[model samples]
Target chain A: MSVVIEAHNISKRFFLGERNQRAFFEDVSVKTIRGLRRLARRRLAPEQSSSRDFWALKDISFQISQGQTLAIIGENGAGKSTLLKILSRITQPTTGTVKVYGRLASLLEVGTGFHPEFSGRDNIFLNGAMLGLSRKDVRKRFDRIVEFSGLAKFIDVPVKNYSSGMYVRLAFSVAAHLNPEIVILDEVLAVGDTVFQKKCFDRMEEIIDEGHAAILVSHGMAHIRRMCQICLWLKNGRIKMLGPTDEVASCYEKATTHEVVAHYEKQTAEQHGPTHPSAIAGLVQWSVQSKAASAPHSIIVSQAKVTFRFEIELTAMISHGKISVSVADAQGLILFTQQGELGQITRGKFWATLELPFLPLKPGEYIVTCTISEADHPVAFLRATPELTVLKDESLAQSGYHGVLNMPARLSVEQIPQA
Target chain B: MAQTSSAKETRVQSVPEIVTGTNDALPSAKPTYVVDADKILSSHPKDLWAYRELYLLLVKRDFVAVYKQTVLGPLWFFVQPFLASLVFIVVFSQIARLPTTDLPPLVYYMSGIIVWTYFSNSLSQVASTFLSSGTIFRKIYFPRLIVPFSQISMNFLNFIGQLLVLFGVIACYKLSGHRIELSLKILALPLVLADMALLALGLGCIIAAATVKYRDLNIVVGYTLNLWMYGSLVIYPRSAVPAHLQPLLALNPMASFVESFRSCLFDTEHTTVQPAVIATLMTIVIAIIGIWCFAKAEGTFTDSI
Candidate 1:
């Protein structure tokens, strides 16, 4: 289990002020003026120029040994890509060191350096050279590369006429056939169709089986969980957690949902001000409350009892009215829908409450909406809450089910002798 | 080593027997690389050696891709210099009454045009190395010098094409019985071309490096190269310049190479050894500085661009 990559205290700094999008002449004039002003103020304000320094990555360190897969997970702008760039040696870290013990290949972009005017055969050689393969290496693997891409029939045609699927297939085929000791991949799996995706995954598995190490930066948690043995979670350019894949992945998922909930809270606070005025005919205001509230309007998983309260103001007499409360996942996929008949009311304000004996949901972010209808026509729809965040119940840790439901089922085990 | 057993258990157990044999052989010796922020300004000769094949392929690509789908194709190489020399013969040799150094005006103008074309084209092409291929440079990692080297080599092939046309013109002049002396100094033509190439590469490297930050250099370089041709003794021979301006003409490094190349064909020596030696030394110094600037910018240009 010899180490293949060892990154030590890797920190990268960037200056935000260096990005100049002005015209050439304007840039010259403005930069000169600013330079003179800065020189004049040099003694008084020494920190004005240094304020533009941005630390994209801060004190990040990790190591991967032979035959290991490491997954990097983070939200956008969490320095995941920067760390990959440093590891790939495409960019240098400002204040750290990295050591590699074997041949390293980085696939930061697919079909990089591919000229659209060049035929597929010529591009194969060109791209292979760009990826660090010698001419002899490419010539030896030429047949296998074309065969894997399934473009042998069209190898002489220019890639500009290639369908996007064929283009990605050709690019991925060359990358997969690279026989390097260590491979760095950045979200390259989310390409092509599902069948090809599976093929790519299989090839990746084979690469690892051949005693190669890989470091992957991907936003797909499913892919990370299935392929990576270790996970590194980044938060604001620092390591939030690093450990076994399952533990770090689950922690990252939980924190991500919490952030989603906070985002929803902020949006609702801005979109709907302090007043809750009924804009529809029937439904006025509706709210959800749980006995075990982790935060304001949040429910703990396995809450046993949950309540949905609604205020309805009917302007005219309504016949055959119905009200329903539905719980949906973050993506608006309805998980549970329950309907109750509304009592006949004429021209007045009334309160209706629906109580459930037990609500079973996994720890995540969800939405609760209340709908009021008459004669099978939906009249008024109201969001019951900003967002429903189901907190984790420590007792459910032993249950090894991964879904939106936490079913209440009894388990019994007994030892029996084999005959 | 506590995680070693767990790591082994998680790896695929069904690896073929031959794959395991390779694993046993790997730990014996392996290459290790250390990366840090401080990159050397000098080019890595070993890395350049490893990528020599890529350099060749790039040159081939440049050669093959340029003439594709053209009307005359490779003949355009000959047509370009011939056309330019025709204009020079009309303006300088015929109207301005410039001396042809006891040689045919076609041969005199053609030789200077081809040699100057080689030097200037190489300089401009190599100067735009980073600007034209910033996309490729940002995405891929290779020996950066390969680009400048490949540009120079590609222009060399173009030089050869135009040289053949010059030779044909000389043969036609000889068939017509003009007193043109063919000397062994023509063997030194390759050395003259090499000197010009070193000079172009050095200047191109510096300009390419500067243009990464101050892109104004790209625009300025195009016009400057055009103006630079007149300063050299391309259209007029060195013997045509006044004695007071003779030293000024020698100050331009390209003047010697162009004069030397013309002398190689006409059997006349107009440039002295001192100017040639001085030009060579200047080319060497400029080349060293150019490579230094190019290597310095190669490591961090992506951030600025």
Candidate 2:
């Protein structure tokens, strides 16, 4: 397979200081530190300075064969936009290089080249020429671009009057119809309504099927998985992993969730350092233990019977103090918080058992944060503990099907005659 | 033989690698510096050759759009100067009783207004080409100077329209037995207009560049043009000013251009010869600085804008 795109050891460094400030000394210091770290970690480390460089992309090397779809995926600030900018020739790489096999067109931002005062028809030609299409080519595709944009009736109108949706549709229509060897799209499909997004996705799929290579940068993992055969996962500025779509996606999910956990840990650690015992005083550790000897390292709620065990080390005996165990989603919305002393042991250690009869939550990962408090004061706090997984219900058959909820009900049906 | 073979292999490998490598770095090639006259002029000749259509379209747009939504339409082109000249004749000649430079008050003031209006309007609009057209320029790649160049062409058309009205008024003066010279030196009017356009565009480009980063220039430009109008002897003769300020007024290119234009029309003595030469030199200097500043700012305007 012929190589269509190649990025080799590319690195980009951006200086983010204020324009008026003297950046010379600060930039020198940063460079020295970066150089020292690179030398120190020569063997064990990846030889990439991930911090302080703000390296939108660092030592990123990749090759794409002809007619291949490569999905670039990561969380926000993952250098996706930087990569696309470099590829689209909007900016230059700080170090390293990228070679393209043919003409490349990018919709980095929708309506990037539209002129407000120009009529829509005139803009189509202008925008087309800006994108490296000849005037004759624009004329040939004019009708199709107009039809696809659904702006046929208003083609002669100046684009200043175009609604935001109409503007994006028209701009996108011009971009999509341009016959380039490589098409780069950066989250432009997120524009317009849901139906329009689907139409754009379908059109992109069609374009990909026509044997032109594509690089799609999106936050939507499902979109990436469905459209791309290969995926690249970026963390900070470096590629964390790159492989087949499923493998890279799974790695990305793990890395992202791990990052979230690490971030929470760092924040809480900072809040309650070893010297600041008063911050999380009074209460002790809590653990969720499963009875199954061969239980999976992680318990999925739909299938497992897990017990809520608490080891509270109270500094003082308190009356009417209760423990609240809450399972919160990623947005910190408490799904369930139980506060009771039904099966609690009075003095030292308390253990409570709750078996989920059926899993009501969707199949995804969630965090369980527990807090033991007296009225308004929290004595102890546990955030993001026992990362719970809710698995598919089919796997629970051998374990006697312990669902996520336990409920008791009575039902009676009495049939009456037609008369 | 061994060394040559190794060198040949390195060369073979390096060529493809370098070609593949720099493909992504091609677009951001705008040079830095504002006063690089060679670079600025060099960019213009090619751009003029390449964007001939764009130039034509810009000229057409300026002509059509200027009067498109106006109440009087294209008639305003004639009406503006006619009204201004009438006001000048009454206020300066009749009320103030200012002396004319060997021409009738109406003809003298009208001639100055005709040339002065083009210079002042061109300067005002051209100074704002970056600010007003920045939205279009940011998203599209075209020679940045084309905007101010197009404004010059646009103003040229309006100037021509006003010139026709001036010609009609001149013919009327002639028909009424008022002595006027139709000298062949009137042919030099194009050169005068060209100098004025260049001076306006050159200084305007510099101001436009400054206005992008320091928006205070916009306010200064607005009031500065008004003061500049009075300074250029538009409604009064240079002799009305004190002797000490005469040399200072002569330094103003528009003052010289307007004086030359009046001399060409009314067969007055060429009092503008010295200033005209000075103004021509000033135009070249301003053009150099303007192009220099514009080129330097073009690379980063996308961020600032």
Choose the strongest candidate by lDDT: 1
Q: What would the per-residue lDDT of candidate 2 be over residues A1-419, giving only the tens digit for each residue?
A: 45667777776666443433244465567668878877887544433543434456788777676667898987667677777766654445666666677656676666765667778998787677656566778889999999888899999999989998999988888877876677787765556778777778777777777656888887666677667877876666777667777667655654455446555655655665553322433335445555442344344444345665555554455554656777754434467987765232244545444444443554445666666555544545655344665444454433222323422333579999898
lDDT digits (tens) for residues A91-134 of candidate 1: 77777888788888877778877878789998888889888899
Error of 2 at B175 (Å): 3.5
> Candidate 1 i-RMS (Å)?
10.0
Off-target runs (Cα >4 Å) in candidate 1 are A17-51, A265-419, B1-31, B41-43
Model 2, docking class: incorrect
Cα lDDT for residue B168, candidate 2? 88
Relative to the unseen true structure, what is the C-alpha lDDT of residue A329 in candidate 2, on a scale of 0 to 100?
47
Question: Could you tell me how far off, in angstroms, the CA of residue B184 lies in candidate 2 after the best superposition?
Answer: 3.7
State how far residue B76 of model 2 sits from its true place (Å).
3.6
Where is the poorest 10-residue window by lDDT in model 1 chain B? B13-22
